[model samples]
Target: MSKDSSQSFLLSDSAMQAASYSTYQNFQSSPTLCASELQNWKQRIGLFQTHLQTTATPTQGSLFDTTSTQTSLDSIKPFELRRQNTEFWRWQFDDVGVPAMYFVIDYIATAQKGPILLYIGETVKSNQRWKGVHDCKRYLTNYQQAHRDTGLKSELAIAFWPQAPADRPARQKLESQLIYKWRSPFNKENWRYWNTPFITGKEP
Candidate 1:
């Protein structure tokens, strides 16, 4: 389940620029004056998706292997992925929850090809996982806000994997598998696959 960077699929100069230093804003205008730079990031991600769809192959790695991820997503019924307004932290049950794996995805991109898996993680306490300060929360907010500001729609939501292993290490291993398989952008392991522009860090 280890997909390393040994594969030799190269992105275009623009995409590379977006993925590396994230120099898009240098030649682009801000979506909002004091807002996080996410609109441009979304545009860059869309370009990456379009290019990868026609060019990606099995040997190239699972970073853009949408077919498998799409199939996996299809297996999960719509009812499985739950949503409870913007402040999703409240979705937890009675302050206690079973250990599980969670997925953050956006459904609005289905018309283009398929839904986007933005992030994945395993938690011993599913309900408490998103209850407090979480970096992914900020990332998701930036993502959804960017869409709203740019006049686009994004059906963002979270879904738990019912078969997640109760063991923490096993859960984490499975979590990593999904993250690499789907190339979820918000996950740090996947930042190399995409620019991760929503987050403020040393990397692009």
Candidate 2:
């Protein structure tokens, strides 16, 4: 086998072993949530769970793979941006108020920088979020058609807090807070990373 392939095998083996060890340790040290905390988490789940149920009805195929409904690239100018798709990947890491994990699109000059566009949004469901991204991509295309000088690319980064507790309310609140807090070059208000708004759903 080639040297690259051999190295990949070694790395894969190491990752598997590390994961196995981590799982064993977690199984040994599980903690229980207090009653009050659990109740709050349940409430948050109920509100956002509806978004999931509504979107789950099925619309189109995988948004990332198909171009049938995708926006064309020739229209919009590409913007310099970066995306961060982060996931906790561990149930034990989840905390009640804090986001268990997130996929962030940081619009800056970073190693992960990619194309950019206008208006970014976050969703609880992965597929729905991806569809949102597709829409952004299309928007970028249309934008280029409208203003050729803008020269920005619309990009999407999908992250999930799968490790987050299944309690829908807590997860929704966490995600909304994260989005509210998210900071990017394109972020107009600069609300995230500061005392902006909670999940009040009201304009701050």
Top candidate (TM-score): 1
Model 1: CA > 4 A from native = 1-86, 201-204
lDDT of 1 at 169: 72
What TM-score quantifies how close candidate 1 is to the native fold?
0.59
Could you tally the backbone clashes for each prediction? 0, 19
What digit string (tens of lDDT, one per residue) describes model 2 on residues 1-204?
Answer: 344322221113333334432111111111233444423332343333234333422223332233431222111112222222211122222122222333433232122322222233433333223321232333223222322233322223323333333466656543343333222212233324222221112111
- TM-score of each candidate? 0.59, 0.27
Q: Indicate the TM-score of model 2.
A: 0.27
The lDDT of model 2 is 0.29
Q: C-alpha displacement of 44 in model 1, angstroms? A: 8.0
Tens digits of per-residue lDDT, candidate 1, 15-109, equal: 43343321112122223422334444554555554455555323335433467544553353422454323244443234445666777767664
